[model samples]
Target: MDEQRPAHILVVDDDREIRELVGDYLERNGFRVSHAGDGRQMNAVLATRAPVDLIVLDLMLPGEDGLSIFRRLRAESRSPVPVLMLTARSDDVDRIIGLELGADDYLAKPFVPRELVARIRAVLRRVRMLPPSALAESAVRTIRFGDWRLDLLQRNLIDRGGVVTPLGGAEYGLLRLFLDHPQHIFSRDQLLAQLARREFEIEDRSIDLRVSRLRRRLGDHARDPRYIRTVRNEGYVFAQPVSYEA
Candidate 1:
């Protein structure tokens, strides 16, 4: 029997020393690592090389910044390759923006290499264990709530008028969980445990941010949310009735 191949990761950063350090560390941990200096190089490598399981993208790049690259990747790529963002310690705005833009996770600069590895593993595990509906090839499974339709196979949100809205990995995961368990109130800790597979210091605010983004995509007002409603002193609940079709 052929041995299973190690997961391949692409590290995209303009910082040469940091890239090499991360690449070597990941390689030492039994992952196949590739390096790219900038967005251009990153795109080139992705186009010609074998499929990458995850991407470690730095927020700061020489020419095209990481956010722009991430947006373009989400818009263009058919594959939902998970992305882990690297940002400076002070880049709070960038970090939130990265999450809103669909990054699976992120680490601030000056982080432990081991932590990065753990995050990578967690993301891969979550992706691998996605719902069977998401993995089905012959048929598309979708959950309809309100006027929105979530295509599990395509990982996109469509409206009554058939407008497609792309969702980030975290956003999609959270939304999927909510749709699967509509009208159920999920506490912050429960949500973190359910959605984020890896052990990380995820703040309650992070979950709030993701929910906020999802609400925006669903066009649900926070104050008078028709879909997701916040329970006082508790957690959020998906108030709308949900129906699934395969």
Candidate 2:
């Protein structure tokens, strides 16, 4: 262990058995585990100095569901840590919903500890692999595309009239990739690799959905698109040239 791998995983679940077991398992596997019983506990723990690197959030919490907590954190307009949803629901629709809600990974109940550890490692690796240029800097840069202005430092989307739009974790990553490499047609696989930094999770169509959300925020008409253009056979392209002010 490097003793400074730079990761703080927050595990939230209502079941004490699951929480303790999962926390212990993750700890033994070289993770700094912080456990919470509910959304309130999660918030309280997050209020302390140690910034959470990722979240292992259960869906059916006692008072506030995982979605609500995720939303509350997202509403603060900051880039949320990547979430790994732990759910009992095995439905495809449920999985899709979680993915849409910005969960970086999903693990159904009765999952092996190894699988969970693997997912955690993948997400943590993504965190570590972020280029130093993206978020850490003195002066933040702004990139304008149609009706949207992306503030890299603040991790926000401002409309043409200057109303700020909050970005989900995965959405923020995808936008960062596009802004970093504009006009290049990247296939879904390439986009996922670039965005997740090799943290493999979710179906490939999730890329389409994330891009769709960005397009909606930009008010870019799908029928007559201006920003991200979809290629029939190849992939998608960020149609606008990006400018960054350091």
Candidate 3:
């Protein structure tokens, strides 16, 4: 067997101190770290270097903000690369927007280095834990409900008109969980535990935000959801009957 390589992480931030601090810390913790001062530098690194496993992006930048860079990354890249956003503590709106744009996770500014390491580990753990057999099986099966088809192998969500919607890692995991257990109401804690592969602090609102984003993707209205329904005083449920094909 070939030797497994350390995960390569790209740190994109305009702040020199922060970029160096995070890069050094992550490198000390066994990750291969690269630094970029802004979006242009980030794009150059991505274009020239080996494939990056994840990105630690700062929300605020001098030019071409993190959000715009993230949007472009998702739209242009051939594969999905998990993004962990760094935002100001008060920038709740930006945080939510980043999540909706398919960010894998986010941390507030002035965060502890240890906490950042923890979050990075959690995201990478989820990404690396997929077994070959499971991936093969999922690739052959496509789950269908209402007008949406979820290709297990490709991890793509296809609509009735055949437009493919992109999903973040957490979004895909949560949706698959719901599809696998249609009509089973899952509590906030239960969902969090299922999706969070490692010990990480996640707020209840984060779950709500992910569900909202998934609902929009499915064309399921929040007020009258045809697929994922919010059970009163209970957790959400997949309301539609699901079928699968291999």
Candidate 4:
């Protein structure tokens, strides 16, 4: 998030009342807010307006659902902005899918506007959390492991086929931490201390969820993993041997 100016936020929801309420609340809290009723309007705002720092996307829409929009955004956008999914449904599956697909955070409906504001700040903080010196291993420029290459300068992952994959803020941070100390097991608390934004946390499940997402980007299966392996009650470890390149 840009500290010099009010962060720009795009609120994408079909309900006019909800959109107005959210946009007004965000503006009141010192944000530059824009409204979008659906995927089409959302795209238009993105294409025409100034760059948005974060997006407040609703999961349930009239034509194209929020998940589809999010997926396309990740695949198409060169610099994917942080996304916070707003869903009326209580199903864990929707939440998991959103997280795995690189959403910054998620909130359920009937939420207090205050809580939403807090989450939005937390997600933005995570995005700007890592400094250039955060990763000691990053001085090497590139880190290679398994069948993938991590361009530290670009802050992206690339497959052997040369396809690039974007990593969310937390995902990039967690992966860098693991690469910095491969074969070293880090308990959940240790990992949390390294990555926590010092903001309000929903639960410890947040750490687990982020680790799972990183593993997915590394093409590591949760059950039969190759790169990041579960250490049972101990926590997790980046088992692969990482090599550095200048």
After TM-score superposition, what is the CA distance of residue 24 in candidate 2 from its true location, in Å? 0.9
lDDT by residue for model 4 over 1-246, one digit each (tens)?
A: 458999999999999999999889999999999999999999999997488999999999989999999999999975688898998756556766775565767788979999899888866765554343432443568888889998888888999999998876677878987876566566676566556532223247788888787877877876899998989887887887776766
What ranking of all candidate models by TM-score puts the best one first? 1, 3, 4, 2
Query: Tens digits of per-residue lDDT for model 3 on 1-246?
Result: 012998899999999999999999999999899999999999888887498888999989988999999999989975668789999988867876775565777788999999999888866764554343323453547888899999887789998889998776778988987875565565676567656643334467799988888898888877899988988866787877676666
By lDDT, the best candidate is 1
Cα TM-score per model: 0.58, 0.54, 0.58, 0.57
Which residue pairs show backbone clashes in model 3? 139-153
The lDDT per prediction is 0.80, 0.74, 0.79, 0.79
Clashes of each: 1, 0, 1, 0
The total number of steric clashes, by the backbone 3 Å criterion, in model 1 comes to 1
Worst 10 residues of 4 by lDDT: 129-138
In model 1, which range of ten residues has the least summed lDDT?
A: 131-140
In candidate 2 the C-alpha lDDT for residue 230 amounts to 95
Compared with the true structure, model 3 gives a TM-score of 0.58
